[model samples]
Target: MSESPSTRHPRELATAADPAWVDAFVVELRLLGVPGDEIGEHLVVLDTHLRESGEAVDEAFGDPREYARSLAPGGGPAAAVDRSTVAMAVLALVGVVLVPAALGAVLDGTRVTVTLGGVLAAVLLGGALAGLVLPGAPLLALLVRRRWVSFLLAPALVALGAGLVLLLPQVLVRVPAPLVLGAGAAAVLAGSVLLARAPADLVTAPGERASGGGGRLLGLLVLPVFALVACVPVLLVRLLG
Candidate 1:
C-alpha cells in the first residue's frame, strides 16, 4: 500500500515548500498589520496546504507581498512605503562611506575636510541606491540562508572597499581622522537604532524558533569578521605606504 501524504516526514514536506518563500510571506503579512498570532496561524495553514496539495506556493497564492497586501484591507501601494526603512538604508550607506575615511584620517593624524559635493553624492546617490536595494535584502538573505554569512558580508565588504578606493588619495594627503571617525560613528549609531526598530522576522521561517548554540556562536563571530574586513584597506594602505 502507498504511504499517505500526511504521514511523510515534516522536514521532507518543509523542503518541498521553500522556507524562504514561507518566511517572506509571513514577513509581508506582518508588515501589513497582521498580528503575530494570526500570522502563525496563517503559516500553519499554508504548510498544511503545501503538504496536502503538493502545490508550489507561488502557484497557489501568487506573490507573497501582493497576496499579503490583498489580505490587508487598506494596505496597498502606500503600505509599501516604509519611511523608517528608507532612512535606515541611507544611514547605513553614510556610515559605510564615512567609517573608512575616518580610519584613514585618524591613522595619518590629519584633519579631513567634508566636501559638500562628496556629502551630497554619498547621501543622494549612495543612500538612494541603498534605499532601493534594502527592502529586498532580507528576502535575499532568506533565499541564501545556507550561505548567510557571505550574503550578509558581501555588500558591507564591497561598500567598504569602494569607499577606501575613493578616499585613498585624500587620506594620503592627511585629512583629519577624528572628524571623519566621529561622523562615521554617528551614522552607524543612528542606522543601528533605525534597524532595531524595523521588522527582523524576514530572516526567520514561520514556526521556527530563533537559533540556538551553534547559531548564536556564528552570530557572535559576525561582528569580528565584519571589523576585520572593514579594516583590510586601512591595513593595506599602512603597510604599502
Candidate 2:
C-alpha cells in the first residue's frame, strides 16, 4: 500500500531551515548523478512541498527523510537550472585563476600600478562565483534565515569586487595600494553583515532593493577607509617580493 502524505517524512516536507543544507543536499543529489535542471526544479518542488506540509523556516527534520525515500521508488524531482553545476564550476575556476594572475600582473614590476580596472574584473568574476558557492555553506544558511540581510550581501559583494578591481591600479602605483585592498577586504567583510539578514525568496528581490539597502550603505561608509589601511601590507609585500 502507498503511504499517506501525513505519514510523509521531513525530507518530503523540506523547508529553508538552512539553505546550506539544501546546498549539501544538492551536492548529494549530484553525487547520485542527477542533472542540474532536475536538481533546481526538484529543489523548487521540494521547497513548495515542504511549505505546503507546514514546515517553517528553520525546522530540522521529521520522522522519515522524504527526498531520500522518494528516490527509492518514484525517483526525485526534475532538475531546475541546467548546467548550474558547470556554471558554478567555471566561476570557481575563475576565482582560482584570476586572483593569482591579477596579482602576478600587478607584481610584474616593483612599481606596479594596482589599478581599479584589473581589480574590478577580478572581483566581478570572483564575487559572483563566491555568491554562487556561498549558498551551500553556513553563510547561506544564516542569510536564508535573515532574508533582508542575506539578500543584501549578494550585490554588495558584486559591487565590492568591481570597486576593488577599479581601485587596484591606483593603489599599487604608490599612492597606497593598502587602502584599496583594504576597501576590497572591507567589501568582503560587509558581505558577512549582509548575510546575517537575508530573505527566503532571495532570487525574487529587486536588484536595487537587494544592494542599495542597509548593507550597501554600510559598505560604502566603511570600505574606502578600510581598504586604504588593509591593502598597505599586501602592497608592501608584493613590492618587496
Candidate 3:
C-alpha cells in the first residue's frame, strides 16, 4: 500500500516542512493565473481535505499540477494573461501616480529637482513592472494566482515606502517649516496611494502569503502617528546640532 503524499515522509515534514515543495506549488499557481482569493480558498480546501483524509503535509500537496490543470482546463496560459492584466494595471497605476506625486511634495527644490525625482521613481516603477511582471505574463495570466511572489512584492514596495518614512524626519528637521509640511504632505499622500493600490489578495485572502491580516490598515493608522512621534527626534536633532 502506498502512503499518501502528505504522509509520505513524516521525517521530512518534521524538519523543514518541505519549503521547496510548497514554494514550487505556489510558483506554479502563479504561472497559472488563479485569482489570489480563489487560490487561498483552494489551499484551505486542499489542506483540510488532505488532513481529514489522513494525508501528511507533503503528500497532500503532491498533486498541485493536477490542481493547476483543473483550474485552467482548455483555456491555457493565454486565458491566464487576460485575467491578470487588470490587477497588473492597478499595480502600474500605483507606481506611476502614487510614488512620484508623494516624492514630488517632499523633495521640492527648484522645479527641476522636483520634476526629476518624480520622473525617476515613475520610470523605475514602470521598469520594475516590465522586468518583473511582463516577462512572466504567461505564468501570471491566471485570474487569482496566489503566489509568494505576488505576496512578497507588496512588502518590497512597502519597504521602499518605509524608507521614505524614516527619511522624512531627517529631511524635515533641516528644512524650513513650509518645506517640512510639504514633505509630510508628500509622504502622507504617497503612502495613501500605495495603500489604496495594495492588492487585496496579498493581504486579505487566507492561505495567501501575507504578513498579516489587517496589517495594511494597522500600518495606515500607525504610520502617521509614528511620523508625528518622529518629530521629537527630529526636533532634538535640530536643537542639539
TM-score of each: 0.53, 0.27, 0.38
lDDT (tens digit, per residue) of candidate 3 on 17-131: 3455544555565565556555545555655665567766567555555555566535335333342444434443443343333333344442312333334444555655554
lDDT of 2 at 88: 32
Model 2: lDDT of residue 109: 38
Angstrom error of the Cα, residue 3, model 3: value is: 33
Q: For model 1, how does the per-residue alpha-carbon lDDT over 76-172 read when each residue is reduced to its tens digit? A: 3323436876776666666666777677767777676555445544544564365344644453334343456666656865576457556643322
Q: State the lDDT of candidate 2 residue by residue for 105-144, as single tens digits.
A: 3555333354567656655665555544543333443454
Give Cα distance to truth, residue 164, candidate 3, Å.
Answer: 24
Error of 2 at 181 (Å): 28
TM-score of 1: 0.53
Ranked candidates (lDDT, high to low): 1, 3, 2
Each candidate's clash count: 8, 39, 17
In model 1, pairs of residues that clash are: 105-177, 106-177, 110-175, 110-176, 111-175, 111-176, 112-175, 112-176
Q: In angstroms, give how far residue 178 of model 2 lies from its true place.
A: 34
Ten-residue region with minimum lDDT total, candidate 3: 2-11
lDDT of 3 at 41: 53
After superposing candidate 2 on the true structure, give the runs of residues whose Cα lies further than 4 Å from its correct spot: 1-117, 120-128, 170-241
